[model samples]
Target: MRPDNEVLIVGAGFGGIGAAIEFASLGIDDVAIVEREDDLGGTWHVNHYPGLAVDIASVTYSYSFEPNPFWSRLFAPGPELKRYAEHVAEKYDLTRRMEFGTSVTGARWDDESGLWTVSTADGATRTCRYLVTATGFLSQPSTPDFPGMDTFTGTVLHTAAWDDSVDLTGRRVAVIGTGATAVQLIPEAAEVAAELTVFQRTPIWVVPKIDFPIPRAVQRLFARIPATQRAVRLVNTSLLEMLMVFGVLHFRQARLGNKAGALLARAHLRAQVSDADLRRRLTPHYDLGCKRPTFSNSYFRAYTRPNVTLETDGIGRIEPDAVVTGDGRRIEIDTLVLATGFDLWDTNFPAFEIVGRDQLSLGAWWRESRFQAYQGITMPRYPNLLSLNSPYSYSGLSYFTTIEGQMRHIGRLFGELRRRGASTFEVTGEANDAFLDEVTDHLADSVFYLGNCAGSHSYYFNHQGEAALLRPNATLTTLRAMDTFPLDDYRFH
Candidate 1:
């Protein structure tokens, strides 16, 4: 197990799995995928909470290479996604190349040898010519530091790390946060809980989800006629891409378009909920596309339930058996669920600390909360290291699509390396700075900055209040930029 490897992939999510397959296809057999969990699906395997599902349509969420013609619903749930990952792994025989329960602690570049020395939690050390970090942006959960959280008599669980054994059949449940996960879980919990109280920090814009069962006949047709399925996927992907362009480049156009979208969403809420006050509270003051828009058919209807209460007052503290609001009001609950989202920008330096050429640590470079990457793949001083779904790589469309594009970009880089007989390659500092300047300038006019969205923290932005996460365009533009193997952009050894 201490043998040298060609490439080391430090995750088993969709991105990591895709990298493994791509590397295998390149005739690189010494590739290894190390997953901390027991299975291949990273987020899907961990977050097994109630009413967990994908927001994107099922067809678009899947990998482009291997299409699944057996999706049961437009929005697939967590279990089905996990099964899909497993099926892909089995089909590609990726399980044999993966080492489960092995967490990457840190990775350091050997300056003399131009190789990465990776360390694992199990005290195993290995060196590889190239290191691929496929750890996803949404992989880590963000659990707020609530005072007296440990002393609470009732159980508390983050939605991403749900404790299923704690039954909520007849319990008084209190859900904290009103993000996408909260909207999805509230409706399901309202059906079984004795009473449900949703604590909202800031109201979110939610649109009606047109989620429906995809009939077996349609699945059969998709299987029989691949052209029809491909056509549907192409149309959906293109529409989303166009919407992203409108959101980023054409602000006036996006604002006008969002007004209609907002009116439709608000009207749907008004029609679903009878309480005028509740409907007003649910209506978002900002534009629809400012924050990540959610889709839920029952979220508005759930607020109308007799046993459910939506509280907009901020939380003060957590009492023994109750939650205290900022206005000195307390609501008692039997269980607490934290639907707070993931830490996208937080630094989780895996045990192997990455040190670049000048003995500079990646942590040190990003200490001021500035994330800089050349095309979100390679760093300026880091040679032979690739990061999938890194900073500025997240797209408005499906993440799977972005990851596929990045994997292809990396694949092309590897081909260029082989053709040139280069042992190591790194982007020049001038090129990296130029790319970052362009990205920051593009983000300045985007909706995340110009929109009149209040109380929204810049998770997508860095410490400098610049958007460092989302990509400007959709699949075609992104892939086109990545398609050109720009060997001139980097310095080779």
Candidate 2:
């Protein structure tokens, strides 16, 4: 079969862009990137809420290969990230290969043709020699199923789909969920809304954000000497590595580090919030590293405002004009903002139908058995299919770190395929099982297994209570493994 493209990536986000860059580096230029959204930038393009910004420091949030020396702040805002995405796409000449507003419904691997036939929502089909699903972990937004949500007369909005025309100034707004997204948005909403009510399902670990503007001189220095920026990135990455490796991943061996992190967050809360009762309600009961933490200088202080009320009572139900708590108390509000996060394991694991060898559905197989990806990229039956956002793929604090690691994996895997003069490659079942065992053993020392994570409804843990989201290794270690994983583990055809 003559394939339309050598490679077809199912996302236009950073992950897809990185995969395309890797494929190009391997001298395979026939690539196409399809995005469901009308534009690139993935999350940056889809989310445009008031106070959206990168949770990690700007120095380490981006790709190491294409470092942007002109970040305005240490924690750059959402717009800057969007701009950075645009810059990277243009610089890499990836824009020409992207198909915006193209929603892929499913992909099926043809045994006879040895090509992946991708189906789009628009009834179009494209067959490619290789298919890479770069769909992000948080692509699918989860809306709550409240009893009376259909009867809500007031304007409702999800953080994923923010309507800017509807202003919150002087509006009686009730924001639900207190995750990372809400932490950044609540403070901004509190300043403008007449009465802001935040419904908390679980209290998040909040630490002070050491965010500040980078001076023009520093930017110039970074541009002039790229090595200087690399040094700063290295320093920042190391600090975050300590937090991830010791404070989270190795909780059993390094409990002190985790406790210290918890203490820091508690202290930050105490300093910002004067009310002891409020502080008690705001503090997370679970361990600090159980759930993903956020850096916020104003989240705790937002509850101090007379206009902002922290509602700890579980939501009983919703009415057209007010929110009824489990205690039977009702709070009237004009706007309802659902900061409720994404559906990960369910809707976003594969994000779309993927039928591999012998008509084995990727999502179904994972659900019936267990979610496993050999080195977080390949499965036994999935020949020439690279699931970029698979379980245990994410390494380190920054998403870019994960992307770069996968890029390295792609480079090595594809180079071996070329050397063998092969058109398709699939991971051996033994290799996949071995990798699964290794990661599972490594996670025994992690916060999910060793520390108290009972109350933390973290996305890290799957339905089977396995914390299979993160790679559970030091960032550097994961990168090395990605580059050096045994090529013999895959059977080239």
Candidate 3:
């Protein structure tokens, strides 16, 4: 049977947006984008807490092809990012093709027809020739199930879904979790809250953020000569690459770089907090790169405030008007905020159920066997399916690097399919295994393996104890491979 559209993208975020632009460039216009959120911008739209900004430099976080010349700061705030997403969508004419407020439930592939039937939450189904799941890695929010949480009478919030209507001023607030989100939020909350208590399960590695506003003259220059911005982007990418390659990935080979990074973070902490006991409690026990490290100018200083109390003692239970600690200490609060990160390995791996050839469930296969994907894009049995946010797909610290690299992969792979006049393409099991093994071997020397990460409650290591989220390679290497990977890696029919 003929499909409803040539391509069906399962997200409207940067990943899905990049895929749409790439396909449109390839003369493929019969496409549709489905977003679960009310609008686009994915994470930026969903997360609008007091202190929401890109951790990576603004120039590096955006698409290299479509650089925004008017970013207000070095690290653009959440609203600016949302506007950038809108601009990209409008420029590419992808806004009209997007269906917002639509949740996809599952999808099934038909071997006989070579078509995929995607079921949505509204009991509607759409058939397409190619299926691309770009649901993103952080789509599902995880809320800690502390005892007596339901009985809490005070206002509750999750950083992923912050309620702006509720006034935080003069409110007694308790924040749970100290991941990247909490690092950005605690300072902002401390500024307004009458009293703030932070519950830390693990102390994050905090580095000083080098942030400054972009001058108008510089913005105009970038707008006039795009090459100037591209040059700046290259410099930023190179700096981040050094951190990822030398300080993290090559932990065994470049232990000095890793140790330097840890020292820098410790020095930053020492300079910010004068209290020795507080500094010790805030210092991370694991390696610098074990968990995701974040740069912040005020996160450390927030703890120095008199109204803010750092609670290292574990949470015992939640009461109606207070949080009881493990040491039997009760801290009263009018608001409860959960900054617990996302559930990546479980519900977020695929984001939704996907059945491929031989009735192989994508999520189940990853859990039962291993989370493996060919070049982090395709699986052995998943014909005509492009899993953009698959295992080992993320290439660099900047997510745009990964998105653009995947775009190149899509372009090259589809170019080959068109050359052969093929309708169906599936990666050979040999190719999948080979790619998985290559990446696994490369990660053997990474901080995930070599460094002390026993105390890091990191989501980087999956349930099977594999650091399969990031592709252990330089950004340039990953891009080059995307451009020139062997076309014979897949069988086309």
TM-score of each: 0.96, 0.99, 0.99
Which residue runs of candidate 2 sit more than 4 Å off their true CA positions? none
Whole-model lDDT, model 2: 0.94
Please, what are the lDDT tens digits per residue for candidate 1 over residues 1-493? 2338889999898888898888888778898899888888988898888999998888889998888988889899889999999999999989899989998888888877778888888788899988999888777788888776776898888998888888788999999988888888999999999999998877787877888999999999999998878888888777677666675545554677656667888888887988889887877777666677778988889888899999988788898899888788989987999988887665543224788778778867765547777887888888988877567777656888778888788778878878888878899888888888877777766777777665665356555565667876556767887778467888877
Between prediction 1 and prediction 2, the one with superior TM-score is 2
Q: Give the TM-score of candidate 3.
A: 0.99
For each candidate, what is the lDDT? 0.81, 0.94, 0.95
Rank the candidate models, highest lDDT first.
3, 2, 1
Report RMSD (Å) for each prediction in the order shown.
2.0, 0.7, 0.7
Q: Report lDDT (Cα) of residue 123, candidate 1.
A: 86
lDDT by residue for model 3 (1-493), tens? 7799999999999999999999999999999999999999999989999899999999999998899999999999999999999999999999999999999999999999999999999999999999999999898999888899999999999999999898899999999999999999999999999999999999999999999999999999999999999999999999999999998899999999999999999999999999999999999999989988999999999999999999999999999999999999999999999999899998888999999999999999999999999998999899999999999999889999899999999999999999999999999999999999999999999999999999898999898899989999999999999999999999999
Model 3 gets an lDDT of 0.95
